[model samples]
Target: MIGALASQAPANAGSPAVERGQYLVNIAGCNDCHTPGYFLGKPDMTRYLGGSEVGFELPGLGVFHGPNLTPDKETGLGAWTDAQIVAALQTGKRPDGRELAPIMPWHAFAKLTRQDVDAIVAFLRSVPAVKNKVPGPFGPNETPTGFVMKVVPPAKPK
Candidate 1:
Protein backbone atom coordinates (compact mmCIF):
# COMPACT_ATOMS: atom_id res chain seq x y z
CA MET A 1 0.00 0.00 0.00
CA ILE A 2 2.75 2.42 0.91
CA GLY A 3 4.70 1.70 -2.24
CA ALA A 4 1.66 2.18 -4.40
CA LEU A 5 0.87 5.55 -2.85
CA ALA A 6 4.45 6.75 -2.93
CA SER A 7 4.69 5.85 -6.59
CA GLN A 8 1.75 8.07 -7.43
CA ALA A 9 3.70 11.23 -6.69
CA PRO A 10 6.03 12.74 -9.24
CA ALA A 11 9.58 11.95 -8.24
CA ASN A 12 12.66 14.12 -8.44
CA ALA A 13 14.59 11.30 -10.02
CA GLY A 14 17.82 13.24 -10.19
CA SER A 15 17.85 14.50 -6.64
CA PRO A 16 19.05 12.00 -4.06
CA ALA A 17 17.91 14.21 -1.21
CA VAL A 18 14.36 14.36 -2.54
CA GLU A 19 14.33 10.62 -3.08
CA ARG A 20 15.58 9.98 0.44
CA GLY A 21 13.03 12.38 1.84
CA GLN A 22 10.27 10.61 -0.02
CA TYR A 23 11.45 7.32 1.38
CA LEU A 24 11.48 8.70 4.90
CA VAL A 25 8.01 10.18 4.54
CA ASN A 26 6.59 6.92 3.23
CA ILE A 27 8.14 4.90 6.02
CA ALA A 28 7.03 7.43 8.62
CA GLY A 29 3.35 7.00 7.70
CA CYS A 30 2.89 10.72 7.11
CA ASN A 31 0.21 10.00 4.55
CA ASP A 32 -1.89 8.00 6.95
CA CYS A 33 -2.67 11.17 8.86
CA HIS A 34 -1.96 13.99 6.42
CA THR A 35 -3.80 12.65 3.41
CA PRO A 36 -7.47 13.51 3.19
CA GLY A 37 -9.96 10.63 3.42
CA TYR A 38 -7.21 8.29 4.54
CA PHE A 39 -8.91 7.20 7.74
CA LEU A 40 -12.06 6.55 5.70
CA GLY A 41 -10.08 4.15 3.50
CA LYS A 42 -10.33 6.40 0.44
CA PRO A 43 -7.26 8.62 0.40
CA ASP A 44 -7.23 11.42 -2.16
CA MET A 45 -4.07 10.98 -4.11
CA THR A 46 -4.57 14.18 -6.06
CA ARG A 47 -4.31 16.11 -2.85
CA TYR A 48 -1.70 13.95 -1.24
CA LEU A 49 -0.41 15.41 2.02
CA GLY A 50 -2.91 18.24 1.60
CA GLY A 51 -4.54 17.63 4.97
CA SER A 52 -6.88 15.23 6.73
CA GLU A 53 -10.62 15.41 6.95
CA VAL A 54 -10.59 13.36 10.11
CA GLY A 55 -9.33 14.56 13.46
CA PHE A 56 -7.89 12.81 16.49
CA GLU A 57 -9.66 13.54 19.75
CA LEU A 58 -7.36 13.33 22.73
CA PRO A 59 -8.84 13.08 26.21
CA GLY A 60 -8.07 16.66 27.25
CA LEU A 61 -5.99 18.18 24.45
CA GLY A 62 -8.86 18.44 22.00
CA VAL A 63 -9.19 17.42 18.34
CA PHE A 64 -6.38 17.99 15.85
CA HIS A 65 -6.45 17.33 12.15
CA GLY A 66 -3.25 16.35 10.45
CA PRO A 67 -2.33 19.63 8.79
CA ASN A 68 -1.40 20.06 5.13
CA LEU A 69 2.27 19.45 4.49
CA THR A 70 2.30 20.92 1.02
CA PRO A 71 3.83 24.29 0.22
CA ASP A 72 0.63 26.14 -0.41
CA LYS A 73 1.03 29.74 0.63
CA GLU A 74 -2.29 30.20 2.35
CA THR A 75 -3.02 26.84 3.82
CA GLY A 76 0.09 24.72 3.99
CA LEU A 77 3.72 25.07 5.06
CA GLY A 78 4.71 27.51 2.32
CA ALA A 79 5.31 30.27 4.81
CA TRP A 80 7.59 28.25 7.03
CA THR A 81 11.32 28.41 6.59
CA ASP A 82 13.27 25.19 6.27
CA ALA A 83 14.53 25.74 9.79
CA GLN A 84 10.99 26.12 11.09
CA ILE A 85 9.96 22.84 9.55
CA VAL A 86 12.97 21.11 11.02
CA ALA A 87 12.27 22.53 14.45
CA ALA A 88 8.66 21.41 14.33
CA LEU A 89 9.70 17.91 13.45
CA GLN A 90 12.58 17.68 15.90
CA THR A 91 11.31 19.77 18.78
CA GLY A 92 7.53 19.52 18.30
CA LYS A 93 7.27 23.27 18.47
CA ARG A 94 5.75 25.36 15.70
CA PRO A 95 7.02 28.75 14.54
CA ASP A 96 4.23 30.35 16.53
CA GLY A 97 5.45 28.59 19.69
CA ARG A 98 2.50 26.22 19.91
CA GLU A 99 3.41 22.66 20.73
CA LEU A 100 2.25 19.95 18.41
CA ALA A 101 -0.75 17.95 19.50
CA PRO A 102 -0.20 14.91 21.72
CA ILE A 103 -1.08 12.51 18.92
CA MET A 104 1.84 13.70 16.79
CA PRO A 105 4.79 11.33 17.10
CA TRP A 106 7.29 14.20 16.97
CA HIS A 107 9.07 12.83 20.02
CA ALA A 108 10.02 9.79 18.01
CA PHE A 109 10.94 12.04 15.11
CA ALA A 110 13.12 14.10 17.39
CA LYS A 111 15.71 11.36 17.27
CA LEU A 112 16.12 11.59 13.50
CA THR A 113 19.52 12.72 12.26
CA ARG A 114 19.79 16.31 11.08
CA GLN A 115 20.51 15.18 7.54
CA ASP A 116 17.44 12.99 7.54
CA VAL A 117 15.29 15.85 8.76
CA ASP A 118 16.69 18.10 6.03
CA ALA A 119 15.88 15.51 3.43
CA ILE A 120 12.34 15.24 4.74
CA VAL A 121 11.90 18.97 4.50
CA ALA A 122 13.33 19.02 1.02
CA PHE A 123 10.93 16.35 -0.12
CA LEU A 124 7.99 18.16 1.45
CA ARG A 125 8.93 21.33 -0.39
CA SER A 126 9.29 19.52 -3.67
CA VAL A 127 5.79 18.12 -3.76
CA PRO A 128 3.25 20.04 -5.82
CA ALA A 129 1.64 22.80 -3.81
CA VAL A 130 -1.76 21.81 -2.48
CA LYS A 131 -4.04 24.48 -1.09
CA ASN A 132 -6.03 22.81 1.61
CA LYS A 133 -7.24 24.41 4.79
CA VAL A 134 -7.62 21.74 7.40
CA PRO A 135 -10.05 22.33 10.20
CA GLY A 136 -9.24 23.34 13.74
CA PRO A 137 -7.39 22.09 16.76
CA PHE A 138 -10.60 22.42 18.63
CA GLY A 139 -10.35 22.97 22.36
CA PRO A 140 -11.46 20.17 24.68
CA ASN A 141 -14.78 21.83 25.28
CA GLU A 142 -15.37 22.81 21.68
CA THR A 143 -17.28 20.71 19.21
CA PRO A 144 -15.20 19.47 16.31
CA THR A 145 -16.23 20.03 12.70
CA GLY A 146 -15.54 16.62 11.24
CA PHE A 147 -15.27 12.92 11.94
CA VAL A 148 -12.98 12.07 14.84
CA MET A 149 -11.28 9.07 16.33
CA LYS A 150 -11.49 9.42 20.09
CA VAL A 151 -8.80 8.06 22.36
CA VAL A 152 -10.25 6.75 25.57
CA PRO A 153 -8.52 5.21 28.54
CA PRO A 154 -8.79 1.46 28.96
CA ALA A 155 -11.27 0.37 31.57
CA LYS A 156 -10.03 -1.12 34.85
CA PRO A 157 -9.84 -4.89 35.04
CA LYS A 158 -12.62 -6.60 36.96
Candidate 2:
Protein backbone atom coordinates (compact mmCIF):
# COMPACT_ATOMS: atom_id res chain seq x y z
CA MET A 1 0.00 0.00 0.00
CA ILE A 2 2.76 2.42 0.90
CA GLY A 3 4.75 1.55 -2.19
CA ALA A 4 2.06 2.84 -4.53
CA LEU A 5 2.33 6.26 -2.94
CA ALA A 6 6.11 6.37 -2.98
CA SER A 7 6.62 7.05 -6.66
CA GLN A 8 4.38 10.09 -6.99
CA ALA A 9 7.24 12.55 -6.72
CA PRO A 10 10.56 12.19 -8.41
CA ALA A 11 13.69 13.49 -6.74
CA ASN A 12 14.16 17.24 -6.92
CA ALA A 13 15.79 17.99 -10.27
CA GLY A 14 17.94 20.93 -9.39
CA SER A 15 19.50 20.15 -6.03
CA PRO A 16 21.03 16.91 -4.83
CA ALA A 17 20.23 17.80 -1.24
CA VAL A 18 16.60 18.32 -2.03
CA GLU A 19 16.55 15.17 -4.08
CA ARG A 20 18.02 13.08 -1.31
CA GLY A 21 15.74 14.73 1.18
CA GLN A 22 12.69 14.03 -0.95
CA TYR A 23 13.67 10.40 -1.22
CA LEU A 24 14.30 10.12 2.51
CA VAL A 25 11.02 11.84 3.34
CA ASN A 26 9.20 9.44 1.06
CA ILE A 27 10.85 6.30 2.42
CA ALA A 28 10.56 7.53 5.99
CA GLY A 29 6.82 8.08 5.52
CA CYS A 30 7.00 11.71 6.55
CA ASN A 31 3.95 12.25 4.43
CA ASP A 32 1.96 9.84 6.54
CA CYS A 33 1.49 12.54 9.15
CA HIS A 34 3.09 15.67 7.77
CA THR A 35 1.22 15.58 4.51
CA PRO A 36 -2.58 15.55 4.60
CA GLY A 37 -4.42 12.88 2.61
CA TYR A 38 -1.22 10.87 2.36
CA PHE A 39 -2.20 8.08 4.73
CA LEU A 40 -5.30 7.55 2.59
CA GLY A 41 -2.89 7.04 -0.32
CA LYS A 42 -3.85 10.26 -2.06
CA PRO A 43 -1.63 13.11 -1.05
CA ASP A 44 -2.76 16.63 -1.89
CA MET A 45 0.26 17.75 -3.88
CA THR A 46 -0.86 21.34 -3.81
CA ARG A 47 -0.35 21.36 -0.07
CA TYR A 48 2.54 18.95 0.21
CA LEU A 49 4.16 18.98 3.64
CA GLY A 50 1.68 21.62 4.76
CA GLY A 51 0.75 19.64 7.88
CA SER A 52 -2.69 18.47 9.03
CA GLU A 53 -5.48 19.56 11.34
CA VAL A 54 -6.65 16.01 11.81
CA GLY A 55 -5.50 14.67 15.17
CA PHE A 56 -4.22 11.32 16.36
CA GLU A 57 -5.63 9.94 19.59
CA LEU A 58 -3.25 7.75 21.56
CA PRO A 59 -4.86 5.27 23.93
CA GLY A 60 -3.75 6.81 27.20
CA LEU A 61 -1.98 9.91 25.99
CA GLY A 62 -3.96 12.54 24.10
CA VAL A 63 -4.76 14.14 20.76
CA PHE A 64 -1.95 15.43 18.60
CA HIS A 65 -1.76 17.33 15.32
CA GLY A 66 1.05 17.23 12.79
CA PRO A 67 2.74 20.55 12.25
CA ASN A 68 3.53 22.08 8.88
CA LEU A 69 7.01 21.37 7.53
CA THR A 70 6.85 23.84 4.70
CA PRO A 71 8.74 27.09 4.71
CA ASP A 72 5.73 29.25 5.41
CA LYS A 73 6.70 32.11 7.66
CA GLU A 74 3.43 32.35 9.52
CA THR A 75 2.54 28.78 10.38
CA GLY A 76 5.43 26.62 9.27
CA LEU A 77 9.16 26.17 9.68
CA GLY A 78 10.41 29.22 7.79
CA ALA A 79 12.01 30.68 10.85
CA TRP A 80 13.77 27.52 11.92
CA THR A 81 17.41 26.96 11.17
CA ASP A 82 18.68 23.76 9.57
CA ALA A 83 20.46 22.91 12.82
CA GLN A 84 17.20 23.35 14.70
CA ILE A 85 15.52 20.94 12.35
CA VAL A 86 18.20 18.34 12.98
CA ALA A 87 17.94 18.87 16.71
CA ALA A 88 14.18 18.36 16.68
CA LEU A 89 14.55 15.11 14.79
CA GLN A 90 17.23 13.92 17.19
CA THR A 91 15.80 15.09 20.52
CA GLY A 92 12.09 15.61 19.79
CA LYS A 93 12.41 19.12 21.11
CA ARG A 94 10.90 21.95 19.12
CA PRO A 95 12.68 25.24 18.61
CA ASP A 96 10.34 26.84 21.13
CA GLY A 97 11.49 24.37 23.76
CA ARG A 98 8.32 22.28 23.59
CA GLU A 99 8.58 18.49 23.39
CA LEU A 100 6.99 16.76 20.45
CA ALA A 101 4.53 13.97 21.11
CA PRO A 102 5.82 10.41 20.97
CA ILE A 103 3.76 9.89 17.87
CA MET A 104 6.41 11.88 16.01
CA PRO A 105 8.77 8.91 16.03
CA TRP A 106 11.76 11.05 16.87
CA HIS A 107 13.37 8.11 18.61
CA ALA A 108 13.63 6.25 15.35
CA PHE A 109 14.50 9.34 13.38
CA ALA A 110 17.23 10.26 15.82
CA LYS A 111 19.38 7.58 14.29
CA LEU A 112 19.24 8.99 10.78
CA THR A 113 22.57 9.81 9.21
CA ARG A 114 23.63 13.43 9.50
CA GLN A 115 23.76 13.65 5.73
CA ASP A 116 20.26 12.25 5.55
CA VAL A 117 19.08 14.67 8.22
CA ASP A 118 20.59 17.58 6.34
CA ALA A 119 19.03 16.37 3.16
CA ILE A 120 15.64 16.21 4.85
CA VAL A 121 16.03 19.79 5.94
CA ALA A 122 17.03 20.82 2.47
CA PHE A 123 14.03 19.11 1.00
CA LEU A 124 11.81 20.84 3.51
CA ARG A 125 13.29 24.17 2.47
CA SER A 126 12.76 23.38 -1.17
CA VAL A 127 9.10 22.52 -0.89
CA PRO A 128 6.46 25.12 -1.56
CA ALA A 129 5.62 27.06 1.54
CA VAL A 130 2.04 26.87 2.79
CA LYS A 131 0.27 28.68 5.58
CA ASN A 132 -1.32 26.24 7.98
CA LYS A 133 -1.65 26.46 11.72
CA VAL A 134 -1.75 23.11 13.49
CA PRO A 135 -3.24 23.17 16.94
CA GLY A 136 -1.27 22.21 20.03
CA PRO A 137 -1.56 18.66 21.41
CA PHE A 138 -4.11 18.05 24.16
CA GLY A 139 -3.57 15.44 26.83
CA PRO A 140 -6.36 13.81 28.82
CA ASN A 141 -4.23 13.95 31.93
CA GLU A 142 -1.16 16.05 32.44
CA THR A 143 1.49 14.83 29.98
CA PRO A 144 1.61 11.04 30.24
CA THR A 145 3.73 9.81 33.11
CA GLY A 146 4.63 6.74 31.12
CA PHE A 147 6.53 8.76 28.57
CA VAL A 148 9.94 7.13 28.34
CA MET A 149 12.74 8.63 26.32
CA LYS A 150 14.54 6.11 24.18
CA VAL A 151 18.27 5.97 23.63
CA VAL A 152 18.88 6.62 19.96
CA PRO A 153 22.08 5.12 18.62
CA PRO A 154 24.65 7.46 17.12
CA ALA A 155 24.48 8.12 13.42
CA LYS A 156 25.93 5.36 11.25
CA PRO A 157 29.36 5.88 9.75
CA LYS A 158 29.27 6.65 6.09
Candidate 3:
Protein backbone atom coordinates (compact mmCIF):
# COMPACT_ATOMS: atom_id res chain seq x y z
CA MET A 1 0.00 0.00 0.00
CA ILE A 2 2.77 2.44 0.88
CA GLY A 3 4.83 1.63 -2.21
CA ALA A 4 1.99 2.41 -4.57
CA LEU A 5 1.59 5.83 -2.98
CA ALA A 6 5.33 6.55 -3.05
CA SER A 7 5.52 6.60 -6.85
CA GLN A 8 2.39 8.64 -7.45
CA ALA A 9 3.76 12.13 -6.81
CA PRO A 10 6.82 13.76 -8.34
CA ALA A 11 7.98 16.70 -6.28
CA ASN A 12 8.58 19.86 -8.28
CA ALA A 13 10.84 22.53 -6.82
CA GLY A 14 9.13 25.79 -7.64
CA SER A 15 8.51 28.93 -5.60
CA PRO A 16 4.86 28.26 -4.91
CA ALA A 17 5.46 24.56 -4.49
CA VAL A 18 8.06 25.27 -1.85
CA GLU A 19 5.75 27.64 -0.04
CA ARG A 20 3.03 25.03 0.11
CA GLY A 21 5.45 22.46 1.44
CA GLN A 22 6.39 24.86 4.21
CA TYR A 23 2.78 25.12 5.29
CA LEU A 24 2.40 21.35 5.44
CA VAL A 25 5.55 20.81 7.46
CA ASN A 26 4.47 23.48 9.89
CA ILE A 27 0.97 22.08 10.36
CA ALA A 28 2.19 18.51 10.56
CA GLY A 29 4.70 17.32 13.15
CA CYS A 30 7.74 17.27 10.84
CA ASN A 31 9.59 19.66 13.16
CA ASP A 32 8.94 17.32 16.05
CA CYS A 33 11.49 14.81 14.79
CA HIS A 34 13.53 16.41 12.02
CA THR A 35 14.31 19.54 14.05
CA PRO A 36 16.76 19.32 16.92
CA GLY A 37 15.08 19.47 20.35
CA TYR A 38 14.67 17.49 23.52
CA PHE A 39 11.17 17.33 24.94
CA LEU A 40 12.16 15.97 28.30
CA GLY A 41 9.52 16.85 30.89
CA LYS A 42 9.59 20.25 29.14
CA PRO A 43 9.57 21.12 25.44
CA ASP A 44 13.02 22.29 24.35
CA MET A 45 11.89 25.23 22.29
CA THR A 46 15.39 26.70 22.25
CA ARG A 47 16.60 23.76 20.19
CA TYR A 48 13.74 23.84 17.76
CA LEU A 49 14.34 21.36 14.95
CA GLY A 50 17.36 20.24 16.90
CA GLY A 51 17.11 16.46 17.47
CA SER A 52 16.11 15.08 20.81
CA GLU A 53 18.06 12.63 22.99
CA VAL A 54 15.26 11.39 25.16
CA GLY A 55 14.28 8.50 22.90
CA PHE A 56 16.14 5.95 25.03
CA GLU A 57 15.16 7.03 28.56
CA LEU A 58 11.43 6.43 28.38
CA PRO A 59 9.82 4.79 25.39
CA GLY A 60 11.44 2.01 23.39
CA LEU A 61 14.43 3.83 21.88
CA GLY A 62 16.37 6.93 22.80
CA VAL A 63 15.94 9.55 20.07
CA PHE A 64 18.63 12.04 19.09
CA HIS A 65 18.57 15.79 18.47
CA GLY A 66 16.82 17.08 15.33
CA PRO A 67 18.96 19.17 12.97
CA ASN A 68 18.27 22.73 11.96
CA LEU A 69 16.39 22.91 8.66
CA THR A 70 17.70 26.37 7.82
CA PRO A 71 19.96 26.84 4.87
CA ASP A 72 23.08 27.17 6.99
CA LYS A 73 26.06 25.95 4.96
CA GLU A 74 27.46 23.94 7.84
CA THR A 75 24.91 22.77 10.38
CA GLY A 76 21.70 22.68 8.32
CA LEU A 77 20.33 21.07 5.18
CA GLY A 78 21.70 23.94 3.09
CA ALA A 79 23.63 21.39 1.09
CA TRP A 80 20.71 19.03 0.59
CA THR A 81 19.15 18.72 -2.84
CA ASP A 82 15.45 19.30 -3.46
CA ALA A 83 15.23 15.69 -4.52
CA GLN A 84 17.05 14.79 -1.36
CA ILE A 85 14.61 16.83 0.68
CA VAL A 86 11.72 15.16 -1.07
CA ALA A 87 13.26 11.77 -0.59
CA ALA A 88 13.82 12.45 3.08
CA LEU A 89 10.34 13.79 3.56
CA GLN A 90 8.80 11.13 1.34
CA THR A 91 11.25 8.29 1.87
CA GLY A 92 13.22 8.98 5.07
CA LYS A 93 16.86 9.56 4.17
CA ARG A 94 19.69 11.98 4.84
CA PRO A 95 20.99 13.99 1.89
CA ASP A 96 24.33 12.34 2.12
CA GLY A 97 23.90 8.57 2.69
CA ARG A 98 22.31 8.01 6.06
CA GLU A 99 18.74 7.00 6.68
CA LEU A 100 17.09 9.47 9.01
CA ALA A 101 16.02 8.13 12.36
CA PRO A 102 12.45 6.76 12.42
CA ILE A 103 11.44 9.64 14.65
CA MET A 104 11.27 11.76 11.48
CA PRO A 105 7.73 10.89 10.42
CA TRP A 106 7.77 10.52 6.67
CA HIS A 107 4.93 8.02 6.50
CA ALA A 108 2.23 10.50 7.41
CA PHE A 109 3.75 13.20 5.22
CA ALA A 110 4.04 10.65 2.44
CA LYS A 111 0.34 11.15 1.93
CA LEU A 112 0.92 14.81 1.06
CA THR A 113 1.22 16.03 -2.49
CA ARG A 114 4.65 16.37 -4.05
CA GLN A 115 4.15 20.08 -4.36
CA ASP A 116 3.42 20.34 -0.65
CA VAL A 117 6.61 18.49 0.30
CA ASP A 118 8.60 20.69 -2.04
CA ALA A 119 7.01 23.71 -0.44
CA ILE A 120 8.25 22.47 2.91
CA VAL A 121 11.78 22.17 1.62
CA ALA A 122 11.45 25.56 0.07
CA PHE A 123 10.34 27.05 3.36
CA LEU A 124 13.11 25.26 5.21
CA ARG A 125 15.63 26.69 2.77
CA SER A 126 14.32 30.17 3.44
CA VAL A 127 14.85 29.87 7.18
CA PRO A 128 17.83 31.65 8.75
CA ALA A 129 20.71 29.23 8.86
CA VAL A 130 21.66 28.56 12.45
CA LYS A 131 25.04 26.92 13.01
CA ASN A 132 24.38 23.76 14.97
CA LYS A 133 26.02 20.42 14.23
CA VAL A 134 23.87 17.45 15.15
CA PRO A 135 24.96 13.86 15.72
CA GLY A 136 23.14 10.61 14.98
CA PRO A 137 21.52 8.81 17.85
CA PHE A 138 22.64 5.41 19.08
CA GLY A 139 20.52 2.66 17.59
CA PRO A 140 18.43 0.30 19.67
CA ASN A 141 20.62 -2.20 21.52
CA GLU A 142 23.54 -0.65 19.65
CA THR A 143 22.03 -2.01 16.46
CA PRO A 144 20.39 0.22 13.87
CA THR A 145 16.62 0.03 14.14
CA GLY A 146 15.35 2.95 12.07
CA PHE A 147 15.76 0.84 8.96
CA VAL A 148 12.49 -1.01 9.48
CA MET A 149 10.80 2.23 10.39
CA LYS A 150 11.66 3.55 6.94
CA VAL A 151 8.53 2.06 5.48
CA VAL A 152 7.37 5.27 3.83
CA PRO A 153 7.34 4.64 0.08
CA PRO A 154 6.02 7.95 -1.28
CA ALA A 155 2.75 9.86 -1.48
CA LYS A 156 -0.45 9.83 -3.49
CA PRO A 157 -2.33 12.97 -4.38
CA LYS A 158 -5.66 13.16 -2.63
Q: Using TM-score as the measure, which candidate wins?
A: 1
Worst 10 residues of 1 by lDDT: 4-13
Stronger candidate by TM-score (1 vs 3): 1
Separately for all candidates shown, the number of backbone clashes (residues 3 or more apart, or on different chains) is 0, 0, 27
User: For candidate 1, what is the lDDT?
Assistant: 0.91
* Candidate 3 C-alpha lDDT tens digits along 46-83: 44454444343213554445666767677777787878
Candidate 2 Cα RMSD (Å): 8.8
The TM-score, computed over Cα atoms with residue i paired to residue i, of candidate 1 is 0.95
Model 3 worst lDDT run, 10 consecutive residues: 1-10
lDDT of candidate 2 at residue 136, scale 0 to 100: 54
What lDDT score goes with residue 94 in model 2? Answer: 92
For model 1, the superposed segments whose C-alpha errors exceed 4 Å read none
What 10-residue stretch in candidate 2 is worst by lDDT?
A: 142-151
In the range 1-158, model 1's lDDT, one tens digit per residue, is 66657575545656888888888998899999999989999998888999999999999889999999999989999999999999999999999999999888999999999999999998999888899999998999999999999999999999
